[model samples]
Target: MDEARWIQQARAGDVESFGRLVRAYQTAVYNLAYRMLGDRMEAEDAAQETFLRAFRHLDRYDPERPFRTWLLSIAAHHCIDRLRRQRPDLPLDPGYLGDEDPDPEAALIRKETRETVQRLLRHLPPTDRAVVVLYYWYGESLRGIAEALGLTVSAVKSRLHRARWRLAQGLEATDEV
Candidate 1:
């Protein structure tokens, strides 16, 4: 069944239908939450909360809207709220979430690069991080990002600009250091 049919079934209290939706979107939802929260445990919790909230308010979802976008919006808003309630700077273990590959050297380089970027991203305010992640990591268009973030397109552009500038300055300082 298509997403619409599954959504309909889920809305009508079909556990199997809901399970399918969760399975289909779990990786994507988890990735978004992880990128937004910068902590695997916190992202897992946030993703669960995102799905629970979505299931609870499925009726409010507009059928005309894309389901993935709607789902991400919930994740984004949940992450933003959580970030607001906590400090953005919580130190992460350097060895956490290491990626392994056939070529050890290449894998090490990739891991270091990713760690650097994620570390810098942690310095950004939540909404700015959300906009940058959606626009760059997800390759979402400006208008699409605006919708996902519940922000105006202009606001999305401004946030992206400011975030990019901040990231540039941050990376520059890291280079100097």
Candidate 2:
């Protein structure tokens, strides 16, 4: 698929071209939302909103920058805004597991681990959580995360460092329980 051509067409008021872009990036956008919000429904909503915002603001998009980066930037900011509106201490629902694993024991362990990680992530400030999620889950570089989240590179590094410390503390507390 020629992403540049699609982007150009989308900019020229072609809805189908935009739909193709959405199909290509939906999983990435939704996964960022899911990791940030820790709720399947909210993540889905955020992903839709991100695409809507992107479509509306296509003219503002700089062609020199990567389209995926720009899209994820919108998703990250939307999730951060949503997080800010809600109570910080609200319990995170682990949501649902994916397809059944052939090994039941392994599946259970993986579920438990995912739940634990989500719980720990819930403690982070929204921006810090976004930094960690983009860095770890998406394998985004520090510079990429900085661009995505509108933070300076040093700020991104600081947030990542602080988030790790907080997550480690959370793990220790859970271990003691």
Highest lDDT model number: 2
Which candidate comes out best when scored by TM-score?
Answer: 2
Let me know the TM-score candidate 1 reaches against the reference structure.
Answer: 0.94
TM match of model 2 to true structure: 0.95
What local lDDT score does residue 144 receive in model 2, on the 0 to 100 scale?
Answer: 97
C-alpha lDDT of residue 153 in model 2: 97
lDDT score, candidate 2:
0.92
What are the per-residue Cα lDDT tens digits for candidate 1 across 1-177?
A: 488999999999898999999999998788888887878888899999999999999999999988888999999999999989976557663633645689989988888887788877876899999998888778889999999888999999999999999999899988898
Candidate 1, residue 49: how far the Cα is off, in Å: 0.5
RMSD of 1: 1.4
lDDT by residue for model 2 over 120-151, one digit each (tens)? 89879999999999999889999999998888
Clashes of 2: 0
